[model samples]
Target: MSYPRLAGKRILVTEADAFMGPMLCQVLARHGAEVIADAGTLADDPQRPAAIVAAAGTIDVLVANLAIPAPSTPAVEVSEAEWRATFAALVDPLPRLVGAVLPQMLARRSGKILLMGSASALRGMRRASTYSAARGAQLAYIQAVGVEVAPYNVQVNAIAQNFVDNPTYFPPEVQADPRFQDRLRREVPLGRLVTAGEDAEFAAFLASDAADHFVGQVFPVCGGWVGR
Candidate 1:
């Protein structure tokens, strides 16, 4: 539970009230990180990311915890508004966040940037065209920027995940439903949901010095549901 490498580390997690935010903050703090949990909206203003970084001051790690409700509209019915909105919520802020934080990290030549992304980008899902596209954009951005930042020893990576127990995706009510449980067993090779704590632990590891060798990696954390 203790990560000396993360002890005294300053980490900023966006949307801290949703989608792995609370658990991430709790785990990182338990491991001795100075977690700045920002439960705020970013897409409302392109400048919000930079403002957050400035407010948080010295950031050793940035967890871009972005999320929007997945659209269930069929591909043909997916409107331009939905598509643009999804990207605005999920894709646009990534560069802004990195732009805001990279200078400090690059100056020190040490920092971690971890994106909380979705496996829908890695695999196809029914009724998720807009969400999948946005998630895919996030993965691509991470891969490209991860390498770009590596020369400065600032690692960038993403946790491409789904089927995790989180309020944003799978809530207790959904888990308790028999149909969802049956589908979960059929779909997820693990035969159960990955706990938020487990996912947060992985995020904590990635933020620690132990993950220095990783760069441009889109790690799939959806149990056996997503691979390669």
Candidate 2:
């Protein structure tokens, strides 16, 4: 399916080598978007997000494709360092990126910010306290900022997803495990993982003009893992 909607649009996708980044870049490019894939990490400096925005020049959309390997430490065992590290990887860069791009979008009264978030934020999972907290923070921030930027014609939204076929989260070795396959059947109502291309296509729609009516929305793309 050709998404002519994104054609000619300039989009910057951060963490472009990880998570859903490469698939998203490919899908958006296939849809005719001028995609700038940034594989840099936003650690070591608070100003990195702004630098990234500046490096992308003018953009019609920003896909915050942020992620980190989830730690399985028990809630009682989670350390402050772990908590901070999780947030640093997933939460801290959001506002900085928005701040950097807001001026340009607000001036033109048009832009889109689509977060490639996690469904783990929307639902509780054992041994994921720190990771869940950081992901939750991301969605909350998007809700607050989405409404704030809406009147200016800037859309901010998120796809809180899980059980999707992606290298970062669900690699071949894990998928081949019988234990993992059983968990997929029992836990996911759809009984299978959603494809990466499918998830990226949803991102494309959110970044397109067709999604202008949407703002401050957290759409779960986890195949009934986190039911509305």
Provide the TM-score for each candidate, comma-separated. Answer: 0.97, 0.97
Per-residue lDDT value at 79 in model 1: 97
* Count of clashing residue pairs in every prediction: 0, 0
What value does the lDDT take at residue 106 in candidate 2?
94
Model 1 alpha-carbon drift over 4 Å, by segment? 226-228
For 1-228, candidate 1 gives per-residue lDDT tens digits of 664558989999999999899899999999989999999768889988989899999999999999988899999999999999999999999999999999999999999999999999988788899999999999999999999989999999999999998998887888999999998788889999899999999999999998999999999988686233
- Candidate 1: Cα lDDT at 219: 93
Reference-based lDDT, residue 111, model 2 = 96
lDDT of each: 0.92, 0.91
Error of 2 at 203 (Å): 0.6
Sequence-dependent TM-score of model 2: 0.97
